[model samples]
Target: MAAAKSGGITAYSVKTKTKNVPMVDPVIDVKSGRYIATGKDADGNKMAAIMSKATAESHIEAGNAKKGSGWSK
Candidate 1:
C-alpha cells in the first residue's frame, strides 16, 4: 500500500448507549493488515461495514486530486 499521506488516516468517533446512557469514544482501527470498521451496535450486537478495495482506492485518488489545481484554478 502506498504510504498514506501524512495525516491521511483519521479516527471516527462512535457513540454507544448503555442502558439508555450514551457513551462516546474514538473507534479503534484494529485490523491486522488493512484498516476496517467492525463491531456491535450501540446495544452490543454484531455488525459489519465493508468496502471494496477498488472503491477505497478511487476515494483516495479523488481526495488527492481535489487537493490540487483544477482547470478553473
Candidate 2:
C-alpha cells in the first residue's frame, strides 16, 4: 500500500448525509464504465462516491491512490 495523501479527497457521504467529508485511504475504481472512489469516512464506515474520470486519474497521478483492476490513469 502507498502512503496516503494529506487532506484526502472530500466527497458527499450518503450514510451521514454530510458534504465535503474527507475520505481516508481512497482508492479509485471503475464500475460499469463510470469512475468511482471508495474509502472510509472519519467514523470508519465505508463510503463511495462516483467521480469524473479526470478526477480519478488525477488522484492516481498524484499518488493519492492506485488505479484499480481493469482501470488505468
Candidate 3:
C-alpha cells in the first residue's frame, strides 16, 4: 500500500474501535521522544499521528499504523 502525506509529512488519523479506547495524547513531544497519537484539536477531535520514516514504511508494509514520521523544527 502507498502512504499519503500532507505538507511533506506522513501522518495517519487512525480511529480505534471506540473513541474511549483510542486516544491521541494531547501533547506531541514527550521527553524529546516521539509519542503516538498525541494530537487533538480544541474540540477533542484527534489529529494525525506522526511516525518516523522507518516506522511509517514498516506499517505501510504490514498494513498497520505505526507512530513516529514527523519532523520538528
Candidate 4:
C-alpha cells in the first residue's frame, strides 16, 4: 500500500443521516497514517477528527464519496 506523507491531500468521509450521500471533505494529512478533518457532521454542526485511511476508503465503498482524483464519480 502507498504511504501518505505529511502535507498530502486526503479527504475524510463525513457520515450523513440519509443513505449514500455524495460529499467531499478537506482533511489535513497526518504523518501517523491519519487525517484531520474539519467539517459539519450529520447534525450539521462543527466537527473534526483524526481518521485512518481505511476509514476513508470505507466512506468511498459506502457510496458517501466518489473515487479519488483522476477517476470518475
> Which candidate number has the best lDDT?
2
For 1-73, candidate 3 gives per-residue lDDT tens digits of 1223221223333443232223323333323464443545334656555445465445435444423335354
TM-score per candidate, chains pooled: 0.25, 0.78, 0.28, 0.35
Model 1, position 25: C-alpha lDDT score:
21
lDDT of 1 by residue, 1-73 (tens): 2222342322222343222121122122324434343334445554333334443344346452122111122
The TM-score leader among the candidates is: 2
lDDT string for model 2 (1-73, tens) is 1122363677777789877788877888787998878889889988877778777777778877667765743
lDDT of 4 by residue, 1-73 (tens): 1222232223233444332222235333344545444444345544444556675565445544434333223
Ranking by TM-score: 2, 4, 3, 1
lDDT of each: 0.31, 0.73, 0.39, 0.41
Would you list the clashing residue pairs of candidate 1?
none
Cα lDDT of candidate 2 equals 0.73
- Taking all chains together, the TM-score of candidate 2 against the true structure is 0.78
Give the per-residue Cα lDDT of candidate 1 at 17: 23
Candidate with the larger lDDT of 3 and 4: 4
